[model samples]
Target: MPPRTIKAAIQDALEDLPEKKLDKFRSALLDRREEPRVKMNSVEGKDYITIAQVLVSTFTEPRALRITLELLREIGCSEEAERLGELPHEPKRISVISISQSIFAHGPSAGASAGRYMSGDKHFVDKHRTALIQRVSTVPSLLDELLGRGVIKQEGYNTIMRTNQEKMKELYAGPLNACGPDEKDTFYHILNQLEPYLILELKSTK
Candidate 1:
């Protein structure tokens, strides 16, 4: 028999869940502040199979399952993640929790690859990842700011939305990861506007 694909895994994971739980799962995916968010509407009245289809189509197979697991955790359905994990899977795809590193992965130092110096502002964001994750809350606003500043486009916004784990995590993984010094400056400025107190505290601690 072929190994269980992410779609099969999702069907299995959600098969036994009650209506309330399923609704919670659906709502967690849809709670993107406003305008329903891209691709979210497809899951509105979708069944597990359809929902899984949408996820697979949007984020590809591996990321689809990761997003499902994250959504399970987000909606207090952690046990669902475990159930999903128990299903047979494709060969050696990192087992479960295949999201590949947490939000604050101390990624490669900026200067390492190209021998280019990492800028001070970018360094600030990198150095303070932990504090930023814990303290930042004006996430939707921050995303808007980043988008308005051209730091991230619509696809970037949607990707971050799909990967649920405190908006800060998504921010780090999506746009912030690719941001240049000028973009990082814009990010920092937005932080000041949306999380003034937290930024102030973090800066003082530096």
Candidate 2:
């Protein structure tokens, strides 16, 4: 027999799950498919450039721009980062969490646009949920370090960490509480927003 496609495998597996779990899985799959697709080539390059322009124009503050650039780089948008870097600095206007959400929602990702369906294995879902929880649990310490290093002032650090906490709450209440296809992209974006700052902190310590 020929190898099964990922969607076929997921459909077969869903038959064995309980009704409630199956409903969640189905809903998640639908949401994932509904998301906008980007081609990631020259045609889509203009769209990404427009997004970069919005980020640069929307976030005028130095610190906000730096964090946004870090997130763009984290999510594999080097061109966007470079574009933001070239813009003239302006005053602060938006919150870190707002910028994070904008990038998570609008920014392009290879995995996001690949049109791949997630596995329906219970163990796989549980494993990813646990990992995301652990990663989110470290935000406090990470924010403290950023504050100590003067990378962000106390007010900014508090604001960003508060945003992180709210996201953690949502994750636990929704995706982590019950794994769904939509959760994978949501969790990955959260990590993308934080990982760069954590990496920078590590480098500063060395």
Candidate 3:
């Protein structure tokens, strides 16, 4: 059989982490809401609580996911009320679905009692792989747009194309498939590769 790919290797590495570690992480995050807030002092040396920062964090807190949904509904209500000078005449119902496929595209799911962690990890890997392809699909269009707008000069167009083609080969169209590279790492790689060409392009424009 042919050798397994790098993406598979990375997935195996991530999945092979002891379940004990995951259990510990889950336990730690469970009570994270009760953790003491970080304190800071103003320039005058008076202690102050960053209420706005705390409120933003609270809204996005793991414990506040449902609350955030409700708050979004509240905001929509307020907007409509301001528009009509009153509340909605008809009650509107909103529903949210935290679908597995969608969450897996970004990271591991957090659904408890779903038995998904065991299988969802694999789904996450597949979704991550597909995401890399979707990202690569943007490279050509980005290049074309840059060329069309004269952002990337015609003389250096070949250089940009060659660099992007190499990236495509590294990510896809190769025996070594890189399907599961995290979005952060993929973006980092893109920035690293494109930085030099971008610098040269900007220099030419100056």
Candidate 4:
């Protein structure tokens, strides 16, 4: 109910996710929080589990999940987030091949929202549509954080953003932009060759 208590509960939930995915989740939440309707607790006075929580619960390292609840307390209080009933199901898991097929077969953005369906974070999707849209606006900042962390590269960012002026761009542009199969192969080939050279240099470090 109190902001301090609500913030603590959220921090705990996030600490449960994979370390790698943490920044993206936080960045999205920070952006999502700008909306007045994005209440931390549900109408029944329970804190909702975020999509990031499901992703962490499903894919993060064992130690990473351990860190989530604790971190949440450090950030906010859990008592404020306690809900009245059972949380929602985790999102479904899809193989890399399935994701590729879906993207290539359909289009980049096609069914991107389905990640919510597959993972356990469906509660947020079902309850907070506007908040999610606000969160989507934070993707570029999340990618920038990932670049700063060295988890992904400039080429990855470029590939990720080329068509990102809209949703689903992350899935489609690489193959769609290809002149043909051979050209696609050659383009990736060139990108692979120069990846290390494109390392993102942080301005603060300089």
Top candidate (TM-score):
1
Over 41-143, each residue of candidate 2 has an lDDT whose tens digit, in order, gives 3223233233333333433233224444444444444554555444433222333344335434554343345422233544222434443443343456444
lDDT of 3 by residue, 6-74 (tens): 233222322333455323322332323333422332112211122223323543332222222222223
Clash count (model 3, backbone only):
1
Candidates' C-alpha lDDT? 0.61, 0.39, 0.31, 0.33
- Candidate with the greatest lDDT versus the true structure: 1
> In candidate 2, residue 91 scores what lDDT?
23
RMSD for all candidates, in order, please: 14.1, 22.2, 23.7, 16.2
Local error of candidate 1 at 18, Å? 0.7
Off by over 4 Å in 3: 1-135, 159-206
Cα-lDDT of candidate 2? 0.39
RMSD of 1: 14.1
Q: Score every model by TM-score.
A: 0.44, 0.23, 0.16, 0.22
Clash pairs, candidate 1, are: none
Task: Estimate, for each residue in 1-206, the C-alpha lDDT of model 1 and write its tens digit.
Answer: 66767777877777767888988888876764422243656887778778777777766676566567656766777687767755665223321111112111333332224322234544667778876875565567677756755678877655445322467787787778887754565566556554544554566564
Which regions of candidate 2 deviate over 4 angstroms? 1-126, 137-170, 175-180, 196-206
Q: How far does residue 164 in candidate 1 sit from its true spot (Å)?
A: 11
Candidate 4 C-alpha lDDT tens digits along 49-161: 45434324433432223233323333453432222001222112234334434444564344355322211332322233332322232245434433443334466435434
